[model samples]
Target: MATIKDIAKQAGVSISTVSYALNGSPKVTPETTERILAIAKELNYIPNAAARSLKTRETKIIGIFLTDFSGAFYGDLLQGTKETLTRKGYELIVCSGKQSHWMLPERMIDGAIILDVTFDSEDLIRYADRGHKLVVLDRELAHPNINQVLLDNKAGATLATEYLIEEGHREIYAVTGPGSSYDSKQRLQAVMQVVERTAGVQLHVIEGDFNKEGGELAAKAIMAGRRDGQAAAAVFCFNDEMAIGMMNYIAEHHSDIQVGEHIHIIGFDNMELASYSQPRLSTIDYSKRKWGALAAEQLVKLINSDAVENERIYVTLLKGKSVGTSK
Candidate 1:
């Protein structure tokens, strides 16, 4: 509600004098600066950030775009991004949906870290052409203004499949994520590759939506295909949520079916709930916090005009009781 003119009128000084004092200009005496600051505090004056940004062309704020805030998977990732940005004198804001996409093109944020599947690569390239800096976690885009921090999905998938193979599961069920998912596609490719090379291995692919419901549906289908109390089979759910869903479904409805005995299972992502299950879920493990931190670090470096190389987060096989030697 208060303006520089009001402060100038109250202080009996010119508008230019008020401006200089408010901005801590050396042209104004320290006594005048202190007096103006005191009046500003009393009047609850807030600086016009929009006008300031126009002059400096920097907001010192970064945005993280997500598809949606769901599940237990995003906690450490977000924490890593926030902590890294905060330590570097930048603030982070999480955004979702198509409406928030304008923040990047409009220069509301200095840079962005993208993990949203809805964001198109063509649109991102257009933004990069306009000199916007970005770090992508979901897909690859080759641009000087854009850098990638992707997971080694191929390696993780291979590890998951190889673990099932090592457990002597010849008839393996592979539950996959959405068709549009880059990670899902990459993992599926790896699974197929491993299945092709391993002797006498067969992979039955089940389409999944990267959710618990998908896993439940896949479990139902698998159960229907097999006879009751038959030999054990190995399943590789593309993500931990689906694996948990399948486990929960079997627990409630098919007590005759035993996990780690009649139906050995493994999943990707190594989500926290993986360990909490009755038979701890074997999964592909990677550092989610490190993934997020690297993305933020790359975005900041890109913003500062520093050369940034695309980075990859490696994966490992985490063995758990949910997987066992098949009969």
Candidate 2:
């Protein structure tokens, strides 16, 4: 509740003198600085950050925007981002929804890292035009103030599909994320490309929302379409969350179905639970921490007016019991 005026009055110094001493300016004597600090401590004075930022033009904080905070995917990514930002002498704040849009344009934070699809590319470009530094994880934009740190979605999807084809599976099912997701579109494009070039491969696309419920529905649809004694088919869910949902649905309701044998399953993201599943999930593996850390690093450099190129986090295929040779 205490202010600089109270500290200055108690220390028997002018307000400007208190400001210089508190800011460690050489214009103020060490003796006066010590007196001002003692009085500030006694008064429990908390300096006004907003007022200081107005003068300095830097808040030393960064905002990370997400669509929502529902899934387990954000934990490690956030840790990476937070740790890197802390090491760079900045604070991290997680934000979601339309309300947080004001933080970037209003200069409440030094910069922003964006992964939320709800933000329109034009809006982001407008912000970049206004000199707001940004690092985008979800989509690409060409602007001097904006940098991209995107996943290698196309390559990862290609790897997943090729793995299934190598196992001698001809009928492939691809479950996708929301229509709005750039990652989903990229992965699906790659899947179609692989199917188109590979002779005798039939690709079935299932629309998914990148959630467990969506996965379960996709599984239901896939199973419903199968004949009484059809051969085993391969499925590639765009993310582990949906893949886990599909697995759970099959386990609980379809007693006759088995994962690795009857239905070869693969997913992307290699989420933590993917390894712990009954038949460990075959997935496209990439470092979520590294993705987050790199985004933060680039955003910091962008903020400091350093030259930085766009970045891509690569992926690899992790084989597991969830996938098997075609029957």
Q: Could you estimate the TM-score for every candidate?
A: 0.93, 0.96
Model 1: per-residue Cα lDDT over 165-212, one tens digit each: 888889999999999899999999999999999989988999998899
User: Cα miss at 86, model 1 (Å)?
Assistant: 0.9
Candidate 2: pairs in clash: none
Off by over 4 Å in 2: 24-32, 322-324
RMSD of each: 2.1, 1.5
Worst 10 residues of 2 by lDDT: 318-327
Per-residue CA lDDT of candidate 2, range 26-62, in tens? 9998998998999899888888889998998999999
> Which candidate has the highest lDDT of all?
2
Number of backbone collisions per candidate: 0, 0
* Candidate 1 global CA lDDT score: 0.91
